[model samples]
Target: MNDQPLSGLTVIDFSTLLPGPLATLMLAEAGATVIKIERPGGEDMRFFPPKSGDVGTLYAMLNRGKRCLELDLKAADARARILELTDAADIVVEQFRPGVMARLGLGADELCARNPRLIHCSITGFGQSGPRAMEAGHDLNYMALTGLLALSRGSFDAPVLPPAQFADIGGGSFPAVINILLALLQRDRTGKGSRLDIAMCDAMFTFALFAQAQLTTLGHAPKNGADLLTGASPRYRLYPAADGHLIAVGALEDKFWQALCDAVELPDLHRDDRRDSEACAAAMAERIASRTAAEWVPVLAGADCCATPLATLEDAFRDPHFLERGLFDFTADADDTPIPATIVPIDRAFRGRAGAIDPD
Candidate 1:
């Protein structure tokens, strides 16, 4: 028997792409029954590259625990079927340009009328009602409007993409999950549902917590690489090693910085805060490059600098620490196919071996 947090909850998912799917995926992970509605063919990510045979690893990963029903919403019969299904759903997640749902007769106003207690959530690129609501966009475009794109280094002139999709997953997916859960809690009191409109552009804007803080307190937006955590301080940044590997340093506190300087035998830099920070940064880089990453790993690990060697994504899987924490495990497909997956973070006792969960 399996025990999960959302054992009997039912989610009727009409959303596609990353944010909506990822939100429902997390719900599914916790044993919610998520019915994945697909087109006659499949999802857009099916065309995504890096496939494992015929199935896209991307699709399989995001949509593992859901049942897919192929339907062409434009067809009258299929639309009716979808409406019927919605009546029995606890939640409906749809991500589309605004008016698409209303055109399909699945608009929130009517959906709630069909089922008085259904939580109807709409995930959109801009929003249901906004100037940019109809504009097409991807992850990068989402961050651009949110000002998160400004945090990373631009080409001495232009903004660059950050390492991850801050807007799509962080803002949109996480917020949708949070609100839906909150709605569920509220429903217990009001015995009514809600209509949630999640705008990717607006959602991502909230992710710029520190960046916005600078604007509010400092009177202007922070420039590229000019903020405290964005390589502005030598204490909290990456340094190249002698062998081209990287050392991640986060010695922000005076005590930690002192420990870092002592570990490196560079007492001169212990308290020199007003020096030409650029020159100091370059000099520190060279000093770091004088030793191999492996050589300095133990040295820094012994220090109070909160420092460590930068790790490659693949290398992270083999890292003894993650393994010990049960971050990965084997799962079987319906046809008895074995699949490798990483465990989402949660208290250990709340999950089965390899992070298997059943809300029971």
Candidate 2:
């Protein structure tokens, strides 16, 4: 018996690229049977660079454990096939503009009418009804509009794009999964499924709460890169090591700050210098620049400071903690050689398995 939480549930996934696909990927990890409906020529992510054979590495990583089927949704036969699948599916996740699904006769209203217990989740850039609902956007665009990019800009001449897709994954996929799960629980009580209109832009407001707090409490909006958490304070910032490597010093609490100061041999930094964050940051930098990141890792550990080297992507994949947890377990890539698979954040007790299931 499959003892996972979502065992026996079926998910029909119509999301391409990152957001919806990632959400369904998590659902699949929890033991849902996800059937991914792709376009006639497959999704755009299939052609993303760094291909292991024909499939993009990103595609293979995100879409592990899901069954794939090509469907031209504009075709009448395809629409019929979708309705047939919806009848059996517990969850239906789609990422399209507001009216695109309705135009194709696969909107939540139409699909839910056929299956009352179906959780129909729509993840869009804006929302179903709004001025910018139909605007073309990507992860960067969403972050720019949401004030997140501005917060990260840090008084720079131009906004710098974040390395990760904060809006796409954080706003779209995470929220969609959370709301869908909540809707499923609600279905148990009411015996009726609901439609989820998750706006990636609207979801970003949750991340702005800290900045918003400054605006509300202090009656002064936080400028770019000028907030407690935005590298403004020396206590919570990134410092450069001697070998050009960066170390993340998250010594936020007083005890951690003291530990960091003691580890770096800069006891004066522990003092509360109210408004001179730049001076404190400069002093901290001068001290940290004395040693390489490799040298400081053990020193910071000895002091028990909340500081660590900022690892590269490859280094992070090989992290001892993640490796010990079997998070890098994999299925075969396009070349039939094993490649690391992305693991869901769910705990091991409720997780299905470490590896991805083969696409059948």
- TM-scores, all models, native as reference: 0.92, 0.94
List, residue by residue over 122-227, the lDDT tens digit for candidate 1. Answer: 9887888878889999888888777777787566666565787777887788889889989999998999999999988887767777888989998897887887
Q: What is the C-alpha RMSD of each candidate to the true structure, in Å?
A: 3.1, 2.0
Q: Which stretches of candidate 2 lie over 4 Å from their true place?
A: 154-159, 267-270, 353-360
Backbone clashes for every candidate come to 3, 0
lDDT of each: 0.78, 0.85
Please tell me which predicted candidate would have the highest lDDT against the true structure: 2
User: Can you write out model 2's per-residue Cα lDDT over 189-292, one digit (the tens) per residue?
Assistant: 99999999999998788888899898889997688888888877888888999999999999999899888888888857435536576777888899999999
Q: List the residue pairs that clash in candidate 2.
A: none
Residue 302 of model 2 has an lDDT of 94
